[model samples]
Target chain A: MNSYYEASARERLRLLLDPGTFHEFLPPSERVASPHLLQLDTPAAFDDGIIVGKGLLDGRAVLAAAQEGGFMGGAVGEVHGAKLVGLLERARDERPAAVLLLVESGGVRLHEANAGLIGVSEIMRAVLALRSAGVPVIVLDGGQFGCFGGMGIVARLCDAIVMSEEGRLGLSGPEVIETTCGVEEFDSRDRALVWRTVGGKHRYLLGEADALVADDAAAFRQAAIDLLDTKPDLSLEALTAEHERLGGRLERFGACRDALDIWSALGIAAPEKLPLLEADAFRAAVAGKRA
Target chain B: MEKLIYEFDGGAPVKATQGPAIVGVVGSGNLEVLVEPENLGGRCVVEILTAARGFGDIWKAVLEDFFARHKLADLRISINDVGATPAVVSLRLDQAVESFLGGAS
Candidate 1:
């Protein structure tokens, strides 16, 4: 309740949903752990680090999935990916009011290698399918691991994304960038630089995330409830508008070195004060400044 | 990785409400325990697949202490460990049993 950022994946879903409404599918007793982990001599979690099931969100039927970031960085393995795909595919038939995806993964599991990559691709397609079918797929990003890699792309494909200030959404994580591009390119140890670049505030300002809330489960729950009726437009005109909006953002701020520069370009007065502001105040101040 | 199994003569069968009660997460220096009611005939079985090898004796001592504290019967306790300390293992075991008896939380 205090912090969704620190709660376990199961704890997050339990707190986010109506009390005692959650019913897990392929529970740990099913022993559906990754076979690749076993082959690689790695410890395998019983549920493959993902908890997927049906639950009532404010008395409406919903399918949800929570990724255990503590286990293997919540990386998508064969089984984990399959579970998500199965849930999304189920939504096509169940036609739940909405599908909540509590994302906390750091992309594909390296232990599973190619299988992990293929699994993420399958999940991406499934998310698109669900969205095309008019099912509201919402992402709650408040986990410590921060959604990145393939999972970040999957988050973008969803109908809506709600994030907490403690949450981060990006393609390549700081460590990954520092490893691939030299330390000079990105100092992963600089926590301030990391947050300013990919933190929830930055994503929200860039119009990458739909809403920003506090790092508490109740805030996320409220935000999800508010957006339950939202159905993203998938028509050709809407897609073209989105494409043009992204292109215009790139053309306007592509040369900016930091978030502050982008914020300044958006005519935000005193952009440095953004992080210090509280969630509600921040939302008010950045009303029309977002990309 | 090492696989260890321990079975003990227990007291009464667990009166859990539904399916298995799972606790903990398989992170570095952490582990997950799955407690499921089974027809073990007054026995509790623990199966561990640990990333840290050569700690079988330590695991046995810890699990022994756990079974002594909670004399749960007809339970299938499975653990997937990633070099978790004995204290963490005991904590997860206790949490698992507590959830098993009180229903999944």
Candidate 2:
């Protein structure tokens, strides 16, 4: 299987979209690199570590963006965040069939600290605005960097999310949590514990992610195509319902420390076995128990 | 960060019919190469912005080896490097050239 987790941003976009249909905006030839990195004596990427463009997904016009995880942990710098915001703003105007964000970021670049934070905020607003404009925003998270920090919040703000078992999503990353809360609270080096806590499987079971896919590109493609029609309801009633749902989730699972505990509380038999199951089997096992 | 420029005489100008091609990523121990077609009077110019300071001699050696192998000309090669070894740099240069020549995508 061609793992989506292992593919670069460009490779993932190429594999996810129709062949020869991706037209990049501000490509490397444009030489639109970050000026902050150079002043800080840091290396800068040509495309600013994010590739945003228009592409055809199942022959449907769509705006897409992918973050290069190998570059500075896919941090959102000024240019990187601007590229995505520009895409979403364009989507708002063009009203494409869908907008796909293959997010693989640890979020805000420390080099451009304030600019990166402002960029993330702008991206959040743009995504929400696009959704309010009736454009379906879909997030595909399966890369090794996963999504953390501000990017994690951006992913959740989308209309729908498709994640692979290898992918993880959370506000604060494992290392951050360990650093701020102590290793006794969250061990960053314990890969298994980290995955179990924030992995795609857990997110899907928690209803945080709409679809749970395998790590292969084909699986992500199929899942993205399937979710192209999902338009989130941003109405007052919908917002109230969402608020209630989240409050209920906190009330029910706030005390749960680990995902296994949450799974057990959801009444799934042999909760430990849930992690061992493949995507298909895991979905089947938690079909009725998902929150 | 250090900016280095090297220009070399070449056998023939490269016929980059397919616009411009880029490869590699600016990551730890890796670099990105952007090869653009230009009219340089049968000369190849390589410009690099590298994070590893005080490696001008090593970079010169690597680019010399690359120009020797490819003999490319009339091309503007730009590289963003982050402490990549000579082997990886050479490999990315060849990959960039191959992509520029439409041999690989």
Candidate 3:
């Protein structure tokens, strides 16, 4: 398991940014601690496992946050949540051209109890607020900590999403799904099947990902930059048309047992090939031909 | 192996008769309780399920501890846990119950 941050930060944005352009705010020096972990007999990191700040890429005013997978699996707690809220609220006030959240979370921090839930809810509010302010909120799920639980909903709500072959996005974790639906519905032990069902490729084909890119940050940044140009706004006519289309899609999947069934319905030709291809090749291969 | 169900009235007929009004997340190391209004003959019923077994007396002691401190009723609260301390759990349960019972709308 390579450091996702290292692999991503290096390949993705390390070269994309001009020298000295990315400025980190509320750095470890600020010592923002997780108010919840103190009681859990655990040590809290300086940024509560998230790296947040303001940075410039091609002179684009970007505010961002990334999970520090090294610390407690990069879970969100009260302070972590508040800091993100504060950052997004500040971004809204400033009306940045774009906001990218490098989400690498296990969703709400259960250790913190209700505080983490409130934190997630507050972040959701801030994301919606950003959209209402007409700022593009972009989410990149490029690796292992794949967004889950409430963050899955958050990603779905984002104006745009960029994913990698390694990226995963879903409301319930495989374990939860298996628990709720039994092995027949899903087998959490089957890693490849899990990836095939919820991996970025599957999501991209589903029209959930605006663009898919390589695991490296450079590729993801380029993809992210490309997607920033598109916005999601619904017209009444379009909404009705969409409902009609989705009605057809839903009907296509009546009583469908697995994502593979949906995949096959979409005519992937070879759904099994999804998880193996590199992010770029896969996206190129499946461009259009899907919703 | 023992059980205790605590009750209180936050000084009035508060919360819904039934239907959930949830707030909070249950992430690793934390838990949140959702309190909703339900008319089971008009009294708040608290049901708790926790992974930390063998603490029934302590659980009762804490809820008893909380109910004795506040006035709350007309709501049913269910708590889901992933290993949180008593203090955080209590605070959230109180807040959820308070929110459900209706306050500053």
Candidate 4:
């Protein structure tokens, strides 16, 4: 697949596993239909929008799932979302060592009415349930489509998130934000601001990102390995502390304009220079410097 | 053309697979696909129920090629397309494997 995310997924597996070790289930063969799209006279994909599976890492069991950006920008439909929630619940029951997700989504599919939204929430519930059950979920964000809407919340729920410069995490897209919050608040046309606001670079700097790596699939694998090895099991106090810190962070953005303002607030003298830096350099520059 | 079902193998039978599971945007340039495990026999049923019906042959050819390339089994696939590319279709197939079989390389 020439698309960056497809390459990323394939590369992620190659770097994470030995050759010929990975297996694909329910592939395109399972003619899973979208209950919503049929009403709109749309074509339905076999797996809907999300893919869930089980794989192994170092002989340890790991539950896996990836978003199909190729299919409707990997949007969530009823069947697709149900499948995700079901598999996640299964993972919780089975208690895999970990669950790894490669997210490339645009959030809920409105065509399916509330079903899609419910599915997203179900997935979130499953994630939180897994967390509550002492299992870990690691979210990987590095697709061109990015994760948006309900998915943004899902990204936040994970135990840890590893992102790429290509990854984006936000509740709303720039255009939607512009439509709702007006262009003054968010210029939908500005790519730089979008990146600065919710892009992986900014998230990494803000401590929302546990790790930031290149788009290289192998790099993602190495990073995932490094992350799985040292998973942070935060206590409720730590979680609260992080939440308090995050609340303050979001408030600071309330009165801010350019993303540079955010960087400046984070104590970077040349905030403008950070965007041009690689993921590692930017990560190093902002290490322990977030508000 | 068979109804087969299976759960996740819980591992990657092969190395890394690539691509998107859904295509086309909710809008014009957007689309979504779900990539997960159907874990059936090697024969995957690619069911395409699209508003674009004449594309049945196109759908068949695509699935045939995808099944041949990936060798997915016990898998059932459903696609909701607003018009994606061959590029997108292939990616979604890869993603289905990735999502279905968590964390395969």
Model-by-model lDDT, in order? Answer: 0.91, 0.92, 0.68, 0.69
Model 1 residue A63 CA deviation in Å: 0.4
Q: TM-score, B chain, candidate 1?
A: 0.94
Q: A1-291, model 2: which lDDT tens digit per residue?
A: 888999999999999999879999999999898999988889999999999999899999999999999999999999999999999999988999999999999999999999999999999999999988999899999999999999999999999999999999998999998999999999999988999899999999889999998889999999999999886689999999999989999999999988889999999889988778899988888897889
Candidate 4 per-residue lDDT, tens place, A5-28, comes to 555343445445545555555654
Cα displacement (angstroms), candidate 1, residue A172, comes to 1.2
Give candidate 3's chain B TM-score: 0.72
TM-score of chain A of 4: 0.90
Off by over 4 Å in 2: B103-105
Q: Please tell me which model should have the higher DockQ, number 2 or number 3.
A: 2
Quality of candidate 2 docking, DockQ = 0.93
Give per-candidate clash totals. 0, 0, 26, 100
- As for TM-score, the candidate ahead, 2 or 3, is 2
Off by over 4 Å in 3: A1-16, A232-246, B1-105
Please, what are the lDDT tens digits per residue for candidate 3 over residues A136-195?
888888756688877888887788888876788888888888999999878989988887
Can you list each candidate's DockQ? 0.93, 0.93, 0.02, 0.20
lDDT tens digits, residue span B1-105, model 1: 999999999467766454788899999999999988888889999999999989999998998899889888888899999999999999999998888778865
The ten-residue window of minimal lDDT in model 3 chain A covers: A2-11
Q: Is candidate 1 or candidate 3 better by DockQ?
A: 1
- For each candidate in turn, the TM-score is 0.97, 0.97, 0.68, 0.74
**Whose DockQ is higher: candidate 2's or candidate 4's?**
2
